[model samples]
Target: MTGAVESPFWTFVKQSVKSLFIVAFALSATSYTDDVVGSFEGLETGLSAALNTSTATTPKTTYEALDQSLGKGLDLIKICTENADAAGFNIGTAIGWLIAAAVIAFGTTLVTVIGGAVLIVSKFALAVMFAVGPLFIMLLLFPITARLFDSWFSQVLNFTLTIVILAVVMAMATTAYDAFIASVDLNSNSGESPMWAAVEIGALTGVLVWIILQISHMATGLAGGMSMAAMGIRHLMSPVTGGLSAARTAGNIINPVSTRRDLESGMMASGTRFDHMIAGNTVINPAYRQHVMQNIGKNWGWQKGGSVKN
Candidate 1:
């Protein structure tokens, strides 16, 4: 006899349980989204404060701080030029001082302009990512699409860290310029040309460009490493979607009716016989082997028919 039908009461209870689970999931997602948005805002604000360059301004943004630092650098260059001119040297010495000032100004301007452009672009990219981040977070509900979220998050973190690193470098450069300006002795006639000081400042600016480049490379490497680690953890947590099942699915799609031996034979027929050698087997195609032997004999001045020396 057929089993008794499931009770209506039990069916209602099951539906209620499912509804409860859906509500709970929705609440959790909402809470998580709020937390993530709050964290992003907080991080932005914190970066702004940490990198602020203005002593007189409260609540300055990172962009403003970097701009202020760049302005200070330009002013420092102007001061150097003015000091050089005011030294009252002869025409020859004045020309030399002008040349030194020009060099320093060019180097500093180049570094600051390029660094500022990069920072601006990074900040814009981060803002765009943040705006679209909730969509990626929602993608976390599906294991198949979780990698998209992981990639987006990794890019966001990379951009944020890059901005921080560049800001710190700019701030350091500003401090160094301040120190250099303070230590300048325009009146000292100790037989040392002030052009040397200008040269040193120019060299420092050149080093700043290198430092910024290294920081970008470091940020990219760290982001790649973190993304790889996150992918590994995700794969471990999702064995059905990420491991042997995925490999089997891929294999089936690529070669639905071909067995492993069939694939190997096809590869061998396609001139991939070297794969056997790479696998530590002595198998080699006769034509390929003969060609290599002929080349070796010819290069070593041996007869092609035998190994005898020519």
Candidate 2:
């Protein structure tokens, strides 16, 4: 009688343990599936944010917007003798070649102009920033010069990325610059009429545009040349049959491809972040912002930056 009672008790204990393990395993699998899905979505969104997309009739969402439109608007009627991609890549390569070859002169000008900020610190980080930042800015922003003519120049030149970046920059800076100029006039205004002030400001704006145009053209042309040289070399090396395979393989390794639909997911994520901030649900960490501000101040300069500009 005692042995039979003990046997039944042991059997029930074993069944309970087995049931617990099955429940735990099921929960773990569900959690893992959810994690994998979230990771895939994160990567997809990041890519689209880097590129750009919009549904508005006017597509100028960044500083690149103005230049891109400027270039596209002008090229609306031009007929290319070649396929669009070929034309763009060739032009970009040619520009790059010319600029790379002539890197010393203009490159020096850019460095000296930009390095003025870091020269004050006269330290290692400052020195590196002073030297490398100018080169990057020149290589990157120089392509916007093509916008003086038409979007086709940038498209054919394949300078769209740079133009887009430039647009972002202008968007960030425009309001502050306009405010500063307004304040300056308010403080330093002569008894001169308001109309006269408007005329003078307008003239200044025109001059600035002209100066930017000159810079943009040279930069874009040089970038285009470089793009062409790269393509030309690739073409010369590969046989007609073997060439495309080699080329495509190289691109796959170099550029890495992605799809458009995934991009929208990221944009929506960023847009939501802004919404969160506006809603006051998300807080801006002051310490982190201050750190960023310090970096930018170093990059642009702090109080004495006025003298560095010209």
Candidate 3:
């Protein structure tokens, strides 16, 4: 009786350990990507401080380049044509490591699930839960469409770029909003054209919109990471369920019903919805870029004229 009680508890502890490794592998998979993303963030931070500091003179050339690439004449597709090697990872290395990690994680979980299928109720559910993530990655990286992965990766990279671009736009809008708000003395003057006031409203509102979108993007990424962690841990804990398999249709019922299909099946049943949520949204997706770009375009015109046009 005590053995029965103690068995599942040990199993849960074991699965928990495996989940930690999933995060470690995922981080490594996208290692250099972050550096590239971070550099752009650094550029943005520099820009934000450049105006008050004497260094603005030195960066005038850079600022000009930024202004040009990000403005009206921008051809969005140019991003892919001149793409850099993914920051810390070569396309080859990231692919290799990521593939290997999935294979190992899946295979390991498969063996455990097949052998342990009759132990616990949660294990049956967990076995199904864990299979989801790696399967998505495998599908995304499968050879025929692997090239598309680069495009997808680029899309995300571009999203990162949009973040920097959006930051700059907000900076300009903020400057304009403040100037507009400061110039008008509502208490002192009669109601003048609310156009400048409207610009203030528009800029502030635009910044708020961008902030919300960016936050959503970040939240999705966080969800994916958490899903991976949870799946990895769940697999480690629930080694046995009395069933045919849980990874596929027959397996989900477990016990006299199913068994895990493969390592992928044992490890993840459904793609981590959270991870998918992250994968689905990119900072540089056309929608996001278009939003910021359109606003910037409008602001660019307005900045040039310092007035509204129809």
Candidate 4:
């Protein structure tokens, strides 16, 4: 016995059910789901606390962790700057070190604040995407709407990668700061200036800033590329839309009443003979061409055969 082919609706239903089951299983098996859900819940709680003129009691929230890390990094810079004299530096060298320290401190602050804000925003966006992911998956059930799902998935992936990159970069910068602090010998009496240490810190800060900028550029490029792809897909689908429009026009042409009414409307609405001909109100003949030339001559104050009127 031969098997029957499934209808499109049933096929879509089966695919949707299978996809949902797979997503449910994957979510249950992964810690990432918990992290996203927890972060969203934490955000809600934090907002509520702020609105009530209270403080959030949640420990190790994403923002709290970022603040703690940034604070420690700043503290390390403070120690280096504050104890510059303990390294047996002369007054001039000490002054130089302090200047460098000030610049490096400003750079560090800028990097940390911008990086932390990006990470926090990206994480929250990821959580939001996850919340609406099922709707996109359902959109994927139809070929006509699949591009919407693709665009959604691309954005979700971009946010995820951005968050991961920012987190890793921040962690590395923090570790580098801690290591630099540990390497400083404040008790040394060898008359060595801490100016070199200040230079190293400044260089590290510059490098960190460059890395963050590169990551931002990369994220923007990815989003821009996805947008271009989506536009291309829409361009490709234009023919389908045009075909539907053509079908409506054909239906109008096939009905005698509609055809007569459309011709009358076209003639009444047209501003020139060319417009009437183009709108199917009249046939394109020598008379229509001569009429167009005459109208153009009148509008431009010119005679036919390329002669201008005085």
Q: Model 4 reaches what TM-score against the true structure? A: 0.48
| Model 1: lowest-lDDT 10 consecutive positions | 258-267
Write one digit per residue (lDDT tens) for candidate 2, span 169-199. Answer: 3332233234434543322123322333334
Question: Worst 10-residue stretch by lDDT in candidate 3?
Answer: 72-81
Model 3: lDDT to the true structure: 0.36
Which prediction has the highest TM-score against the true structure? 1
In candidate 2, where is summed lDDT lowest over 10 consecutive residues?
A: 73-82
Ranking by lDDT: 1, 4, 3, 2
- List all candidate RMSDs to the true structure: 22.0, 36.5, 38.7, 18.9
Kindly state the number of residue pairs that clash in model 4: 0
lDDT of 4 by residue, 138-241 (tens): 56446687777677767765675565456556656666666766776533354444566667777887887788767766765766575545444334445654
Superposed model 2: Cα runs more than 4 Å off:
1-60, 63-155, 158-162, 165-182, 185-192, 232-310
Judged by lDDT, which candidate is best? 1
Report the lDDT tens digits of candidate 3 across residue range 1-310. Answer: 5464455444444444544443443344453235433444464456445533333422233234233322311221121112212313456443433343333233323322322221232233333433332333333323464344344333333433333334344344334434544664322124333233334444444443455346335534643344343333233345543221244345333423222212222232333333323433223455544544555545344334366589
Local lDDT at 292 for model 2: 42
Better of 2 and 4 by lDDT: 4
> Residue 156's C-alpha lDDT in candidate 3?
37
